[model samples]
Target: MVELLTARGCDVIATVGDGDGLLAAVATHAPDVAVVDIRMPPTHTDEGIRAAIQLRAAHPGVGVLVFSQHAEPAWAARLLAGEASGIGYLLKERVSATADFIEALHRVAAGGVALDPEIVSRMFNTGSRPLDRLTERERVVLDLMAQGHSNRSIAELLVISERAVEKHAASIFTKFDLPPTAADNRRVKAVVAYLQESKP
Candidate 1:
């Protein structure tokens, strides 16, 4: 990961082992973004998630990108507890793709969300009829949106017109009770609603 980031022109400041060392390295190096693993030494259960929360509380300016194998909805919700900006949660598979992984890091560092599509699907499975309210095509559109895909990209991926994608997105927002407004990000809000309604 450090090699990839460095190749992309990002400075590799410090690397640590355990969560405590992670915090120490962040305090010392103060890197623009920190990529954390979900499991660390010792307990290795949720040490990394705990460390991420602590990192956010201690250094609000530092962006956090959690790359983990587990797509556990509960942990994802916990990591995104307070502020959604400058935070990202991705599955391990996403990181295997160099371009997407780098893009996710850049997005988080630039104060955007990078949620994994699988995590969103897990959240949807745990939800009640909120997801069922949408048609299969709308659900596909929503899934793409949750994966942080642009309307054009979603259209291309689904082989549909951009206008159709926009229509589906609008319908999804309405069905999810996310009104279009400047005060809130409709896409993020809809995803948040799914996360909030999800069970562990």
Candidate 2:
């Protein structure tokens, strides 16, 4: 993974063996972003997720990329409990696509979300009542929004006018009953709504 990132021109900072070391390295080195494995040495269960959460709270400026061998919507939900910006989650299998992985890294480092498409699909299909209220097009727009795409970007991808994307966004917010709130980021709130519903 380090090789792939370095080959893509990212500075390869220190690599550590345990979650403790990871936190320490971040405090000391203060890298722009940290790519973490979801399972770690001792338990190999959720040490990485715990560490990532701690890192986010301690250094909100540092971006995080949670790369895991398996898809765990529950874990993803836990990681994103509070904030979603400057964070990403992707299946390890995606690393095989060099360009895609690099793009994800860049996006997260720039304070954007980069959820895996599979994660988005799983969350959408998790049978949330509010989500079921959305039209098919609205659902598509919501999925792109969850991926941290701006309205313009979503419009370009869907080949629709930016105004249409705005309309879909408004509809989604209304369906979810998430009226604009200064205390919350609406996009992250929408994502949290979807993920919270996906909880078993």
Candidate 3:
């Protein structure tokens, strides 16, 4: 890919073999976009996407484009994470279409999304999104809640008001279909739902 990009007049900053190396290169080079493969050294599981998520959080300006050998709806969901700006996910096969791949790279660098057709089709399939209903903020709140943080603690961590955190929590419960119940702990149930469905 680096060779292809360089040949096409795209300045390839650096290439790394592992996720850690990728992070280091991104931090040092600060390229407009980073082309990542879904599989990497040590595990070859989902390290690339995980690193991409961290990269986005750390360097919000950089775009990410992930490539996978097979269709992975779960990884796509994690990669998007309720936001699509400056993100791209394409199958390995898509790289063969040089024009399309280059176009996808350019699109992501410009804060636009470029999703492969198959990935888009699978993502929209019925019952695929067990947690897609949660808004981005609500998902973050729930993740903190799952870590055993109280509303006050979550508010402090997020630098938001306790009332706002409560509201987000309530929305999460509603979206999880956990209605008010005295006997059942809705918060615990919501966290459980998050734990079960949020897994890749």
Candidate 4:
């Protein structure tokens, strides 16, 4: 998998065996993204998921892509807490297609978030809080922002001005208690906060 990713133009920064190694690699290399298995050495009981969460908390700039044999909704909820950008949780079975996997990597590397459809369906079915406070337009903006879209790109997609996009972003930051700053920094903080609040 690492070779494939490298062959497809991705820079393979480092590879680790266990969750601790994964976290260390993330801290040391500080790569743009991380791909972690759901199970890692030393208990192999959701260690990767835990490490992924810790990585997000410690290094918000690094995107995380978690692969698991099972659709662990609890793990998904944990990862989804605080922030959504630069984060992904996927089933190992879905990675068979090279193109799809590569696309997912690109999406995450670019600061776009992705979640397995199965996981989304499960999360919705498990009875979560209703996202009714946000308007339709706000939701659209949030999704694009989570996908790492710039104000210009968002404005273009929404047929609005960059200033309008900025206003919407400001509203989101206020609502989420995220500091309004440079886009990248704000995104990381917002995502971390979003994930933190996702828990019951």
Q: Which has the greatest TM-score?
A: 2
CA RMSD for every model? Answer: 2.2, 1.4, 12.2, 4.6
For candidate 3, write residues 1-200 as lDDT tens digits. Answer: 77889888899889899889888999999999999998998899988989998888888889899999987767876776634567788899988899889988997898766767675345334343545887778867866654345799899999999999999999888888888876545655664444345346
Model 4: per-residue lDDT, tens digit, 143-194? 6765456789999999999999888877767766666555556754544454
How many angstroms is residue 117 displaced in model 1 relative to the true structure, after the best TM-score fit? 2.6
Off by over 4 Å in 4: 127-200
Better of 3 and 4 by TM-score: 4
**For candidate 2, lDDT tens digit of each residue in 1-200?**
88888888999889998899999999999998999999998999999999999999999999999988877788889888867788899999999988988999999998888899889988888777988899999999989988778999999999999999988998888888899887657877788777877667
C-alpha positional error of residue 78 in candidate 2 after TM-score superposition, expressed in Å = 0.7
lDDT score, candidate 4: 0.74
Best by lDDT: 2
Candidate 3 CA-lDDT value? 0.77
| lDDT (10s digit) by residue, model 1, range 44-110 | 8889999999999999888999978878877877877777677889988886798998998998898
For candidate 3, the TM-score is: 0.63
Lowest lDDT block of 10, candidate 2: 182-191
- Each candidate structure's TM-score, on Cα atoms with residue i matched to residue i, is 0.86, 0.95, 0.63, 0.66
